[model samples]
Target: MSDPAGRLNIQLRRTPHGFACDIGSTRPVAASGLFCGRSPAETASLLPLLYSICAKAQASACVGALERACGMDSDPEARRLRQVQVAAETVREHLWRILLDWPVLSGEEPDRQAMIGAQSLVKRIFGAADPNGVLLSPGCEKPTSFRSVLEEAASTLADLMAERVLGLAPDAWMERVETIDAFDDWCRSVETPAARLLVGLRDSGDGRLGHTEASPLPDLDDGTLAAELRGTDAATFVARPCWGGAPRETTPLTRHADSALVSALVADQGRGILARLGAQILETVSLLRAIRTGELDGDSTAPSDAVLPAGVGLGRAEAARGLLVHLAEVDRGRVVEYRILAPTEWNFHPDGVLASALATLPDAEETILRRRVQLLVMAIDPCVAFDLVIP
Candidate 1:
């Protein structure tokens, strides 16, 4: 890693609007760590664009890391929180989905209020009331009440649905475009903005809560799981004779370790897991910071695999929205190739990731067919659209 962002983490909050929520983490936010040379503050400023909805995803990823580290599944309240987290994410997604579809549904008016209301609810649900409850947290003391937040969010959802049915936009308002797609496609495609929180909250097999026989997931060792995500082939090692020199290219997590040289490598050069584990430990911290700062939520999962390969590599990070991948290749300690396989790309690939590998190459045009494109995109719960119009 060249220069890693010194330190970083996502945190979480529960705003007191009864049960409001947000779930996101590291999208365009704090392009910290190793992706860019940008400063944390600089990266911090860009977070809003990547996910203005619920940053619960990022927070969730961190929490997942915590759970994985400590080996705790979840308690009743935690489980409920996870479910609600997903629900809130669904609401957030639908919030935009309904709004986005309005234009095509009809030359309708846009319900910007409802849209904005969803935004606020994201804070309420995903945010924690002031700490002291004395005033800082939600219920403790407020110029506002939780009811208003929920009321507003509900009203917005109602208004948005009404607009869809009537094919009219809500406002003394502005006009917005509607995305017309088949009913089924729309149903699955539209969902909470930040969903990793829900994934973590639910039984996504982190080995903590509910790995029961009835539970739908299998037990996955976090270490093995993280490695699996990188693909079995990703462990190819390169010996750096320079020892202390910067890795031609490294992960933010790696750089974080190196900068804290004491923590990165051993004086004897055999620190291996110790150093990696140390970096992993730091990743959890950065995740917490992201959560507290509203950079993420319970909906997102930490990216464990990067495909930045020797010949070429792919780095896959499960961001608040979905998996964001990076691919690279280093030739004799020099950079040979670098590419990104964003979550969307993997999701939108013709065959799924595993399948694509099986098929040898991809059929981009065939994959571009409307339904196919939609399915592929939805696979990763993609936030972007697949405008597969026949040209």
Candidate 2:
């Protein structure tokens, strides 16, 4: 209705110290009005249509919350299926940024053809994992023989990443290219635009720009999140979420913070643009490996839904950008309350990671400043279109 996902507005002002940032969003915390009266089944069916980006993740969270609220016991395979779908979606999102946006940032043309192929491959992967398209529905039967589908999809995704983003196989990159020295060599040697962007930032002395001391969001249990969602101040908290009285980041950099590649990058550059870029690449590789191995042990710091009082449930899905949360209240077999806490709210909070990082930027020419801001914003990867104003 309002704009599937609303727009983000970022304004920056040059300061004697560095820069000041103001992040604003038109996204609503309570998207409940649209599905307040729908049945759990109807709500699940409609959520994907309402969310164009990360539709699978949205639907998965919606269904999980609704099922718990409705007192439905889901098939265990259902969770696995959801994981595969979300994992494929994550890979697709990362590839979209690397294959398309990274090139433009590096002063090269977008790899449209590679992106097209990547999209097609992702659809095949999603299709194989969800042949009936009912994976999000409560009590839906898991498709049989989807293992082969995933197997093929895994190989295809790895191959695509190799040619388009990594310029080497994922295993090789992780084993031989993730070290501090080796990573720099890869950036210098790889011909892909992803590598070019990282190298450009390092060579231009902008690699350490946007460094922040913001901590990654800790794993929040469902009960804790559910209590907050049901609290009297739920609306305010959801709009500008903070845990332990401080805003924490939930992005690729946080999700894969433990990876050797990401760790090495962060050690070298702190949690800056270069580290963020490396994290994205690392996550893409890791998810592809998970798909190949048929073991998506889930990477979300937020656990799945847990039912609280009768008819109240909280669901979480680790989306491409970060964690997505949904709170649902069902009464008499119909939806009564629905609220969403999206990752954008946390990462782009007025005092959150992006804001802190922006404050660390070095003063520069207007064009260069804009470029730096763009890199930081892209690293956060907000779902909504962002209008950047620097004055």
Candidate 3:
């Protein structure tokens, strides 16, 4: 299992005009080196144990990379199963952030019942897809008999979204989310947990706080990624992920850039706190819908042959937070190298999303500034515990 105790230490210095923020993240990057010399199957089996936050995504990416290294195609059924697993994991993570973390900004306790319901539903969905309880492995076949269970889970998620999160039926919320005005009206009037939290942020001026120019989406091809891996140490790769020679944001907002709701929020609010939170909620609904309709499968193909070397492979997956990448090199059927590029590395880089957002805040009291920092960081939802120090 992943080291649950990994953490991010955030230091905020009060500059003459504004606060300057720096982050020290202690996520596990060196662990990837342990895969060296392991067989492809051995590496695949160890991935879930190494990454607990998005175990399914990690497993999928690892297996896909290893399969390509071995010149094998992924079984379609296995690919679909991994997609469902990733979707389930994404819904659970999004709900946890929205229901458990967002309320802190409003000085309200989380709705425990709602949290429990969401967790239980996700467990059911994941269990149905992987009844044997094995973390996904390369070529791991799944029976097609879980459709009914998935449907039932979808119905339950729809009810929870309507009753607790949005205070409107899924369809109704979808219709209303198309425009900023409609969304603002809902935020002001709806009593759902999500809406109330957002309204609180607006009232406290935090909705507009922490605004920064949104980073461009990453466009890394396998060849570029392989070259980078060959050129850098694992720690450097994990701590300072950059695309096109610059830091970029790789959260839900960037992951679902095409969503109408997300576009509306970005247009109205920029890529501030409100827009980021809205993107997470919209993505939750989208993933749930895909799960319901059995359309969650992503591209299972390896990168183009020109990019794929005989002994090196790369795999990419859209995790709950953002893109996840795994690269592996094998020689004589033994692993020679492995690297994982997690989303947090990109989003939390010193010059990346969270730091840029923090640097934009106007002057405020220390306590107030700290609270705002807390909310903004939660909105980004790093995978590790963080300490905020203002000195």
Candidate 4:
């Protein structure tokens, strides 16, 4: 059982190859066990309370799983609104890192005022798009026409990102930064916190730090995922998931691996710190555009739900961090078994992507090693705090 409020403990001991990293999590991996014995509806209501970090994604997965288990038909409008909320939340999460965290990496103060404005805009626009709060209710729909509100907010957000973060319009930035050399030029020329952080890493010769060979997780049908969750060692599987006996990554880099900018960076940098950071920036641009147009690029699949058998189902949502999944087994309208396989389990597993990158760090001064590890960790963006131990 992982601790619900627990953090990751990363212990790096010197090894002949450089370092041997052991990652341990106290996060409550079994928190879904709380859903057992509750009615499906009750479980849906309880999800938001239990998981507060990505509340919308958590609730979306729970509602979809319960709806599928009950054999309910999909609600298109509900799905659209949920996507909008998720998209806005994604932009917010990425901007938080850009506006607040990136500056600290460059020895600058975080722009608190900008973050406050960003959050306010998010609440106004996405909140207007889904005023009924129906995300938690299965098969429920109360549509409100807020197109103008959404479009205006999207435009404002785009402008804000251009002014405060990108140092250029999102479209212009994407168009210009297609090659590795172009990326370097932009980092050196742009006068923004995000750009400065990248330039700092490059100037310090740490741009390719933490390069790893972990492949991005591939798409799996709901049936295959349900079977894996239904296995005898489901608990172990959720805590430290592996596909075909190997750990895979499910972060922004994985989600945007095929995008022009990200692909070019990864091709040259080998999925290192710079490539990972590039993916997040690229995704934010895509998400902001989606908010305006009501369409996410390459996000064709709606929240997926598959009824494995009578009263058993699996649900999936493409969350900000990665994929969020929930499985439910109900009998007589009450939950018999419930499981959640969060992206955290995949990206932060003991031998997962973070571990692979940490293992590659060459022995150096304690401060240098610690900073490199922190950058890699931040690039991946774990849901929990990490405690680093270098001994």
* lDDT measured at residue 373 in model 4 versus the true structure, 0 to 100: 86
Misplaced by over 4 Å in model 3 are 1-5, 133-135, 141-145, 232-235, 300-306
> Candidate 2: global Cα-lDDT?
0.84
Cα misplacement distance, residue 34 of candidate 4 (Å): 1.2
Scored by lDDT, the top model is 2
Candidate 4 has an lDDT of: 0.83
Model 1: per-residue Cα lDDT over 1-391, one tens digit each:
4212121111112233221112222223223123233322222233333434333433323233323222233332342243234335545654453344322222345556666766575556433321222221111112222434433544454354434322322321111211112211322333421122212222322112111111111222334434433443332211110112211212222234344432323232222222222233233233322322334332323323432223332222334333333333334333332223233323222322212211222223533333222322222234443222322
Model 4 TM-score, 2 decimals: 0.95
Computed on alpha carbons, the lDDT of every model, listed in order, comes to 0.30, 0.84, 0.80, 0.83
Clashing residue pair totals per candidate (backbone < 3 A): 91, 0, 0, 6
Per-residue alpha-carbon lDDT of candidate 2 for residues 197-246, written as tens digits (9 for 90 to 100): 89889888788888888587888778888899889998898899999999
lDDT-superior candidate, 3 or 4? 4
Better of 2 and 4 by lDDT: 2
What tens digits encode model 4's per-residue C-alpha lDDT throughout 55-126? 877877788788888877757767677777778888998899889988987789999888998998888776
TM-score of each: 0.35, 0.95, 0.94, 0.95
| Sort by TM-score, top down from the best | 2, 4, 3, 1
If both were scored by lDDT, which would come out higher, candidate 1 or candidate 3?
Answer: 3
Candidate 3 structure quality by residue, lDDT tens digits, 55-96:
878887888788777777666666677778888888889898
Clash-forming residue pairs, model 4: 2-27, 2-28, 3-26, 3-27, 3-28, 4-28
RMSD over all Cα atoms, model 3: 2.2
Better of 1 and 3 by TM-score: 3
